[model samples]
Target: MSTAFCFGIRFPMFICMSSFAIIPTSIVVERAIALWKRNKYEHYGCRLGFAISIICIVVSLIMSAWSMGKMNLSDLTVYCSATTNETADRITIICFTYCGIDVITLSGMAWLRTSNVAAMKGKYSDLRSSYQLRENASVIRVLLPLVVFDGLSHLVFSLGGGVFLLFRVHFSYVAYRTI
Candidate 1:
């Protein structure tokens, strides 16, 4: 149960970091590019992305530290299962909640990126830069795999998580704990 609780909090962090880390990183790169090129940068999309990501992080931290913070590692023994129906339900729900947020944020970032691209195309229509077109194409190509893999990974996660939620096996036992 303790193990489940810990993972219930941490697994979402893993999914968010692994699956959607690129969005933040790309946003950072966008800003850097603007700085490097000395262009007047519109940070609206990046700002919105950062705001949403921060909100997600805060929620994750709160959920991770919520009930499990008071419990000490010394109190949990490997011999005992440490879960109740309420705990199990909360953990399951938290897991799904985090996963859902991850999916939503990923789509949100995609939507923002599309809008940014459209805006850029409109803004730069006059001075058509082949280099920029090539760069955009390359970014889209690279992002294609990221989006595909993200979707596939989330699908697998959802199915496996749904199974765990269905079986109520989150209370198996606390084999180990980490800080």
Candidate 2:
């Protein structure tokens, strides 16, 4: 395939996949902050979350564009697999970095929750505060599993890419060539 054709197919896919990969980390951090600043978050959480999502999208766009630009079209054979080993390595590093950030955000959220619970046990105990805590807990309960799943998927993908790189295993579209 021509380089432009390959890029046309890969560019949007990269942007979408990268955006999906990044938005989760943004959400985790936003939730952590919301948990930390309870009352203030309640007032502006939606706007804050939207802003964070936009930032994630913009970051994803930039990263995808840069990576796509770095892709080696000369490597293209019968199919649209044009990325060089260096580009693959960079993508794997990015995936691992995102996974690390997710882990750290989860840890921070846990710490914040514990501190909030301890504080609630003291003089600040109130029905509204308790209700907000429960609501936050419920939201976390729902989001936690999804985030964990996303992280694990990323980890597996990164490991697979690492293994492929280690072995120098490059798969081509032989079936397409035959066709």
lDDT string, candidate 2, 103-148, tens digits? 6655655665576566556554555566666666777778777777
The lDDT of model 1 is 0.49
TM-score for candidate 1: 0.49
Worst 10 residues of 2 by lDDT: 170-179
lDDT of 1 by residue, 1-179 (tens): 46555545555664454334334434434533432332323335466457756765765556655523434443433433223333455555555654665565456546645644664565444333434444545565575566556655764675465457667553443422110
What does candidate 2 score in Cα RMSD to the true structure?
A: 4.1
Candidate 1 clash pair list: none
Leading candidate by lDDT? 2
The regions of model 2 sitting more than 4 angstroms off are 72-77, 105-128, 169-179
lDDT of each: 0.49, 0.65
Off by over 4 Å in 1: 1-57, 67-75, 79-86, 125-140, 169-179
* Highest TM-score against the true fold, candidate: 2
